[model samples]
Target: MPIRLTILIVAGSALAGCSWAPPVQESRTGQIITAPANPSGVQRGPHGETSPVLLTARKMIGVDYAYGGHSPETGFDCSGLVYYAHKVNGIQVPRTAAAQFRFADPVPRDALRPGDLMFFRTSGRKISHVGIYLGPGRFVHAPGTGKHVTVADHRSTYWRARFAGAGRVKTNYPLRTSAVRNPR
Candidate 1:
């Protein structure tokens, strides 16, 4: 085998076991590594507003606020909406704002992307509320009692004062719809 071919084979084998590595594909000429496509068809990088999690949250706009609720039929709370959206998109997250904040990978406010979590200290706590960033300083969230899920600008006086931080969620494998167990 040629020197180039030998080097390619060795490099490919070295990367095969890295779970965090992007996919490596064998092209006609050589191996090429590329980022995996989001299963929900949302484009990665800058266009994150189209992510399935965001889409799911957007669908809940106008849903009545129900403390501790996590589904459309029962309405949703701030964290419940986040939980439901991430759940449907195969991303498992904590069910409370504080827990979610503690578990997420922190992102700076200046660097927040469209599906990043926007945390707030609304209840005079460390992180009492959360919303999904929708880019351009706007975010979608289920406000408190008597309010509905709505998009609000983070730069607004109320939210700006309460803005605690931001975070990014890593995706897990897409969930299987079947609940039946396979004996095999």
Candidate 2:
């Protein structure tokens, strides 16, 4: 019964229509299921798991770490991993943890969703580390020098204590008509 309901939700969620309407789908048993945020496509992460951005991060697992590196071939540092994933998705996240923290709108812990960026103050009182939130208290990150990309518990003692905050980035920046020059 649960499997049937799950299948119904997975199929119905794809056709979420109407802007003013909440993405609420009904199950075979008349249960209500909320639509996922940004149900656009698999470009954000792990399909049937989380956002496609996270799927991209998951694909980077076991990639070697390199200081200031930003590609799979050269390996990646913490922020570099974020940069590579987001940049590939057409999101312009800065190449440093602090800057990346400032790249998106603030998101409270209770509101975190897949594709949100998790920031941490691992060293001191400033943002020093980052990871891609994959929901369910899990995230993907490039840990540090000599380490490989891996998934970590976002709510664990180590990460929870240092948790600075999280944010949701806009893949498409809004265009300002004023920024466009009149050819006239």
Candidate 3:
């Protein structure tokens, strides 16, 4: 039966010391299957989820919005959520929406992956809002004054009209090396 063949293949691979290879899955027909390598090259979690930065943002959902706030206890603004999330994950980013937009590396809308920053010009002529992209045209952010942190659809009329652009944070910063004192 197909089940026996699948078992044999798995056992044979195990006996052949192939345990060091990437994990495999079982198909509907009981066949062993391995996932194809990622083409977009975005770093994902063990379950193929977004990076920790986005995870941090996701945890902030339902948090009350507070202008110029920084943490969950103190509440959060759009940029405050982004800043706190990145900082918690050992990544440093600017504290305001405009500054964060200018600091990030520009990414094309079509190529956006999870964890990319989504900028929006909600008011005036400048980038005034930011969110953490969660893939599939969805993102998480702390929407204005009376709103709490929440996920949003970029395809919606309100957001789509104000959609500014996307950007990625540079995660690689030089590590500080302690200077050795000279004993003269």
- Which candidate comes out best when scored by TM-score? 3
lDDT string, candidate 1, 60-173, tens digits: 666778999997778799999999999988777888888888767789998877788999998675789999987676798999899988788899999999988888886654
Candidate 1, residue 161: lDDT: 95
**Per-structure clash totals for the candidates:** 0, 8, 0
Q: What is the lDDT of residue 13 in candidate 2?
A: 47
Clashing pairs in 2: 44-51, 44-52, 44-53, 45-51, 45-52, 45-53, 45-55, 46-55
lDDT of 3 by residue, 19-138 (tens): 234459999999999876543323465587767888778767767799998887777999999999999888878788888877777899988878999999998778899999887768
**lDDT-best of 1 and 3:** 3
Q: After the best TM-score superposition of candidate 1, give how far the Cα of residue 168 lies from its true spot, in angstroms.
A: 0.4
The model with the greatest lDDT is 3
Q: After superposing candidate 2 on the true structure, give the runs of residues whose Cα lies further than 4 Å from its correct spot.
A: 1-50, 174-184
lDDT of 2 by residue, 1-184 (tens): 3554345344444442232243698999999998666543322334455555676676677677898989777888999999888777666667888877876678899888888899999897888999988766778899998798877898899999999888887656722112111110
The residue ranges of model 1 lying beyond 4 angstroms of the native Cα positions read: 1-49, 173-184
Rank candidates, lDDT, best first.
3, 1, 2
**TM-score of predicted structure 1:** 0.68
**Residue 170 error for model 2, in Å?**
0.7
Q: Is candidate 2 or candidate 3 better by TM-score?
A: 3
| Cα misplacement distance, residue 148 of candidate 1 (Å) | 0.8
TM-score of each: 0.68, 0.68, 0.69
After superposing candidate 3, which stretches have Cα over 4 Å from the reference?
Answer: 1-49, 174-184
| lDDT-superior candidate, 2 or 3 | 3
